[model samples]
Target: MNFKFHHIGIVVNSIEQYEKQMLPNKKVREVIDKIQNSKLALYENFNESYIELIEPLNENSTSFNSLKKFGNHLNHLCYKVGPFSELENFMRDRKWIKVFGPVPAALFENQKVVFYLNRNSQLIEFIISE
Candidate 1:
């Protein structure tokens, strides 16, 4: 149940626009993730920490409602976790409910990612450690 801070996900109306306006000179990796129904732009710092910008692909996208409600804001905190099998026990012990995933993520080279909502209703993402 080891957790390492990975990235802060931000929901944006447009990845291209956000990158242009906010991260003009930063190196970013962009991906169109069909599985997640969102476009993503990842900016990784020297320490391996990242800032993930997410844009919904359509109305059915998972981030659509969040974007509609919050309008371009911090979405979730992601962590890299190992011994992937222990996730269930860890979530149960902490009373965190799985909301989505354990699905392959295009942004992480298809590594599995899971979403959870803690008691406080804070969304969190857990990506299987490489």
Candidate 2:
């Protein structure tokens, strides 16, 4: 499948408290302040991968629903890819069942994204930057 590692999505009940727990440094705090809402706090590790700490707007939100089931856990591993159909077919052939969309993601510059559940029940997100 045509894919590029983007970020790891983490569902958290509260973004502020979680950030403090994960990243409790002045420099990290400075970077966190730059991003409004600051839901997705960037903590660069060995690799340049990002950890998106997503908080639910309300009980009805997708993140909240996921939080209820999973409880502050790794929701998905995202990948930025192209020619959407090619990857879609690849997943289908491998029997990686589609879970959620090819929906328009306002956060990702209104790009199209989708989700699939792998054999281990680990959710994988595919985002296409068109």
Candidate 3:
């Protein structure tokens, strides 16, 4: 199992607003679509992984509240991992709270990233890519 810092997910109220203000180049529209449709966006230097800008797409999304309160800023730090359950159980045994998902399946790629809301006042996630 190998691990790497895949991306930093920034929580924003509107992806449109951030893209217009931060990434106004017409050529970068594809990046925006990749995020909207794929839940991931690549940085300009494609060699690095990406900075995933996420907005609420559903009622269950917690990012909506974070966006409302923080007004678009760094939200979560993410790292890529393997064997998600091992990490999940480790966190659970340590008494950290699992807030969002351990959904067995994934929405983007073959990856399963679980969102955890901890008492230390930060949101953390673990990603396992298949």
| Candidate that would win on lDDT | 1
Cα deviation of 13 in candidate 2 (Å)? 0.7
Computed on alpha carbons, the lDDT of every model, listed in order, comes to: 0.88, 0.70, 0.61
The candidate 2 region of ten consecutive residues with least summed lDDT is 27-36
lDDT of 2 by residue, 1-130 (tens): 5667888878888877787887542322122211223244444544555677777766656566778887999888999888678887888788998987887665565578888999888899888765
Could you tell which candidate, 1 or 3, scores higher by lDDT? 1
Error of 1 at 61 (Å): 0.5
Q: Ten residues in a row with the worst lDDT in model 3?
A: 27-36
For candidate 2, the TM-score is 0.77
15-130: candidate 1 lDDT, tens digit per residue:
87887776434556789899879999888654778899999999989999999999999999999998567987899899999999889999888999999999999999999864
| Candidates ranked by TM-score | 1, 2, 3
Candidate 3 per-residue C-alpha lDDT over 44-114 given as tens digits, one digit per residue, 9 for 90 to 100: 42445556667666545556566677777998876777787677777778788888665432334435667
Each prediction's TM-score versus the true structure: 0.92, 0.77, 0.68
Question: Which residue segments of model 1 deviate by more than 4 Å?
Answer: 23-25
Candidate 2 clashes between residue pairs 3 or more apart in a chain or in different chains: none
Off by over 4 Å in 3: 23-47, 58-60, 104-107
